[model samples]
Target: MDGQLLTYLFVGISFALYIGIAIWSRAGSTKEFYVAGGGVGPIANGMATAADWMSAASFISMAGIISFMGYDGSVFLMGWTGGYVLLALLLAPYLRKFGKFTVPDFIGDRYYSNTARSVAVFCALIISFTYVAGQMRGVGVVFSRFLEVEIDTGVYIGMIIVLFYAVLGGMKGITYTQVAQYCVLIFAFMVPAIFISIQMTGNPIPMFGMGDTMASNPEVNLLDRLDGLNAELGFDKYTEGSKSMIDVIAITLALMVGTAGLPHVIVRFFTVKRVKDARKSAGYALLFIAILYVTAPAVAVFSRVNLIETVSETDYKEMPAWFTNWEDLGLIGWTDKNADGKIQYLGDGPAMEGDGNKPAFDGVSKGVNGERVIVNPSNSVNELYVDQDIMVMANPEIADLPNWVIALVAAGCLAAALSTAAGLLLVISSSVSHDLIKKMIKPDISEKGELIAARLAAVGAVVIAGYFGINPPGFVAAVVALAFGLAAASFFPAIVLGIFHKRMNKEGAIAGMVVGMGLMLFYMLKFKFHLFGGGTSEDWWFGVSPEGFGAVAMFFNFLVSLVISRFTPAPPLEVQEIVENIRIPSGAGEATH
Candidate 1:
């Protein structure tokens, strides 16, 4: 079959499978909708968690970031995976033992304050909605590129599919569907990576292939060749660090804590039955996630080498078909500056001579017919950096792979985006319905009414998220960074203090969250939005970029909470005993309230 046909076939089959699962596992009660009735097996929960965690950013954009950023990109790999360690060891088991339906439930009951819980719900909604918008945007990009449909049409189709299953089956349906998505996305990502690895380094395992000797010349190590290429192109080395030590450390810490604090990932643990299952599931989740994390750097190396080799030595007119196809997509373009019909990819700016050589078009202003054939136009400058998100999607075509593989990749990208979108939407809906409406404002509301409210809230969130996707304020990486910062500053400290420290009063917890979130937002907007009339990073406070500002905010939260708790009464004795009960697994089967 042709590639496009195969793409449609693969995507169609996958969607059918998801819809089937939704029908098979539709929620029957509030318990089923919220926690899948707490009947999930650890292995299945692990798979679903992996899918939920690896969003469009991971599938479509991470490798591309690594490809261009070189060693600096290791921050993402380490930050995201290391977060699971924190979640498994410090957060997951205790949260599961608390046996709550949603994250805000734990905050409300543990702190003994509706006010604290309401504040948490507000922060959760903001973080999840911001994060989901990016995922929906990714879905639109994939559909438009592969299905040959308009971006808006693709988004609408995706929205309907997600709304159908997510509303029908709730968390239970989403969990089963996510497991299948995990399989599809992982296979799609690794197959091309393995093929490219073998072609470049003769190593089947991409992780090992990244550091192995090159097939073209075994004498030179893979890292060494990459360093040489980067130096030739006025870029940093692949193995050496470029960013300041402090920035790297701060950003990595922020991402790790933020990942642990994300409500959607935390809530997944509530679906499993036992505290032990939650711990075991975290280990499994990390293992499943590591497959792609390890393979990503290898893809980066292979694709970067291939791109340079294809473009560096060839004349612009002789560039490969993949180049032209991407150019048609507005991803790649070229100009014949000097009318010499030769495209130059060099270190110095365009129109500069090669060492003392004159411009490539200095003497060839007009063509042989004497018509005006200006070789170097006024704005014909070659930029070395291409958008990072394009690297993974464009990799298959760059390697001359079959069309079906390209289409399958497109489907995989959508799967990644949709799975995460569904999870984030659930978080938004649950915070509004379960936390705000049921617990705070309408304590006497019926279960059926809450469910209806939840569905309506989900629809509203989808509309807002769709708008952000269409007009994304920044690139994928930048948006994710902001999300991480917000989550870290607001949620991580609150949850950790609520769980591990019984003395943390509602007053302290609420105050800490408000202060943390406020400070982080201020710093982010100050650097990112030029709010308060502050200059860029060059004039930032202590040179902290918006990306690394979360660490500072989190620390301030901790310090204020500790100081405030000392001066305030601890949570009520009943709440203190409840915390004690949550610390053990024996009473987890019993309801605390």
Candidate 2:
């Protein structure tokens, strides 16, 4: 079959499978909807958590970011994976022991104040919605490019598929579906990577291929050759850091903490049956996630090398089929400079152009006329601006893989995006129905009424999230970073203090969330919106970019909560005993009072 036909077959079959699972495992009560009835095994919960954590950003965007940023992108890998270590060691087990339906419930009851719970609800909604917007946009982008549909039409297709499973089956349905998604996405990601690795280094394993000798010329290491190509093209070495040390450290730390704080991820721990399961699930989740995480850097390296080698010697007019193919889809583009039919791949490097022969743009080229245009006046090196997200999707094509493989990858991308969208929407829905409405607004509401409210809330969130996807606020990776920052600044501190420190009163939790979330929002808007004028790295307060500003805000939250908690009265004696009970794994057997 042709690639397009195969793509439809794969995607169609996957959708059918998901819908079937939803019907088979549909939730029967609010308990199942909220916590999957707290019977999930460690392995199952681990897979679900991996699917929940690896959103559109991780699946589609992380490799692309690493491809371009090179060594600087290691921060994302380290921060994200390292955060799981924190979650496993410090937060997941305790939260599971708390035996709450939602994160806000834990905060509200532990702190003994509805105000703290409300603040947490606000934080969860803001973070979940912002993150969901990116997932929806990714679904649209993948659909548009691979399925040949308009972006809005693609989004609607995604929304329908997600709504079918997420609304009908709730957490139980979403969990099992996510486990399947993790398999599809991981296979799709690794197949192309393995092919490229074998082609370039005669090694089947991409991770090892990254450091292996080149197949074409065994005298040089693959990485060394890549470094030479990059230097020749006026780029930095592949494994060396170009960003400042402090920025790198701060960004890495912020991302790590942010991952721990993400409410969608944290709540997954509650689905497992026991506190021990939560801990074991974290380890399992990391293991499943690491399959892709470790391979991603290898993919980045191999893809970058493949891209440069393919385009380095070719004239612009004779660019490969993959280049034109992606360009047609708006994922890649080029323009002829000086009316020459041939593409000038050389930049302002000494090897490509004569010394001091910088290339000049005429200010009218599609991909070549930006203030930071990749091309230089020297015309010595190729100045290309390929979108990072295209790297993984285009990897199979670049390595001359079979058509079926390409089509399968297209389906995998959709699976990854939709699986994550379902998880985030679940958080958004449960927070509103379980935390805000049932717990706070109408404590006497019946279970049936809460279920109805939850479904309605899910539908409402889908509509709003779909709108944001149609009109994306920012790039996929950047928008996800903003979500992480918000979660880190607002929720992580409150949860940590609430569980670990007996003296952390409701006042402290509320004040911390309000201040932390408020400050992070202000910083994000200031830089993202240019509220104070054109934003620049030089203009950052205390050398913190908006991406890393979450750490600073989180620190502020921790400090403020500590100071306030010391002066404020401690929790009531009953609450103190409640904390003690939460610390024990056996205590989780009882339902919440």
Candidate 3:
């Protein structure tokens, strides 16, 4: 079968499996909808957690960004992986012991205030929506290429698919569905890495293959060759770091704390039966997540090497079919600067005209050299524009990998995108139905009414998510990192203080979250989106980039909370005791209230 047909087959089968699991495990009660009745086995929940954690950002964009940013990309790997460990070791068990349906549920009861719950719900909504937008964008990118649909149309399809499984099955359906998605995504991610690894380095294991000598030239190792290629093209060495040390540390710390504070990943532990089981699942999830995280650097090296070897100075008319195929999608472009028919991929010159690096094509028209006619063609010597987002998806085609391998990648990308989308959608819906409505607005609402409300909230969330997907703020990983930064600033301090500090009161928590979240938002909008009287890197406070500002904001949150709490009355005796009990290791399973 051809690649397109195979892509359809693989994607179709995976979608069917996800929808089937949703039908099989559809939640029948508010308990099931919220926490899958809190009875999931550790192993199953671990796989589900892994699937939920590894979104499109991990599977599609992480390596893509690494391929371009080189050593600077290590921050993402370190921050995200370290953050998971922080979540697992420092947060999961206590939260599970507390036995709330959501993060807002825990905050509301633990702090003994509906206002605290409302603040948490607001934070959760912001974090989840920002994060889900990346997943939806990933979906659109994959569908636009494999299924040959417009990117917007692809997002529409994704919204429909996510809406069905998420609204129908809720947490119960999402859990089992994620288990399957984990398997598919991991297999899909590793297969291409292995194939390209052996083809390029004569080693089957990608991690080791990345360090092995190139098959064509035994004298040079892969990384050395990659560094040489990068130098030849006026780019930074792949092995060296370009970002400042402070920015690197800030980004890494922000991502780490952000992962711990993420409401969606935190909620996964609540699905399991016991506090011990939550700890067990976190271990299992770490193991599962490691498979992809470890392979990502190798994949980045392989894809980056293959891209430079294949595209640089290549003739536009004689370009391979994959080049034209991607060019047709307007993701890959070439301009005939100096009237040369050959392509130029030098790093010194801008490949695009405006601030945007992406090409704005001229409606299927072709240049004289058979390159896609881009309206925003630059005057720079470089004539190529390849979006970094395409590196992972286009890697298989660039390496001339087999049809089955390519098809499997398409399926894996979908699995990664949809699994996390479902998880975030659940977080958004649960916040509205359980936290805002049932817990606050109508404490006496029926279970059925809450379920309906959750579904309706999901529908609204999906529509909003689709809009952002169609108009993404940045590339997948960049947007996701910012979301992590938001979580770090807003939720991390509150959750940590709520669990560890007996004197932490609602007034302090609320004030801290508001100020920290507000600060992070202001920085993000001004630096990232250029909204709040936008400023350049020179204007950044303390030399911190927007992506790393979360750490600074988080510090302010801790500071504000500490200062405010010192002046405010301490928590009630019952709330203090609840905090005391949450930290105790004995009878943790029975501590679920």
Give Cα-based local distance difference scores for all models: 0.79, 0.82, 0.91
- Name model 1 segments beyond 4 Å from true: 333-381, 585-587, 590-593
Q: For candidate 2, what is the lDDT?
A: 0.82
Compare candidates 1 and 3 on TM-score and give the better one. 3
The residue-by-residue lDDT of candidate 3 on 1-593, one tens digit each, is: 89899999999999999999999999998888888888899999999999999999999999988998899999999999999999999999988888886888998898899999998999999999999989998999899999999999999999989998999999999999999999999999999999999999999999999999999999999999999999999888999998899999999999999999999999999898788899999999999999999999999999999888888888877788889888887778787876778888887764441223566788768788878877877666778787777888999999999999999999999999999999999999999998999989998999899999999999999999999989887788988999999999999999999999999999899999999999999999998888979998889999999889999999999999999999999999999999999899954553232
- The local distance difference test score of model 3 is 0.91
Residue 299 of model 1 has an lDDT of: 85
Question: RMSD to native for every prediction?
Answer: 5.3, 4.4, 1.6
lDDT of 1 by residue, 1-593 (tens): 78879889889988998899999999876677777778898999999999999998888878877887789888888888888788888998888888776777888888888998988898898788768877877877777777778777788888888888888888899999999999989999998988888888899998899899999899988888988987886666778887777888888888899898889999899888778788888999999999989888888888888777777646666666667555443334345445455554544442221111112233324443232233333343442224456778889888888787787787788889889998988888888888888888999999899888888888877887787777655556666767888889988888898887889998898888999999998887777767788665578665666877887889888888888999998788888887877777663562121
Q: Ranking by TM-score, best first? A: 3, 2, 1
lDDT of 1 at 465: 77
- Residue 366's lDDT within candidate 1 is 40
TM-score, candidate 2, is: 0.93
Between 1 and 2, whose lDDT is larger? 2
Which predicted model would earn the best lDDT?
3
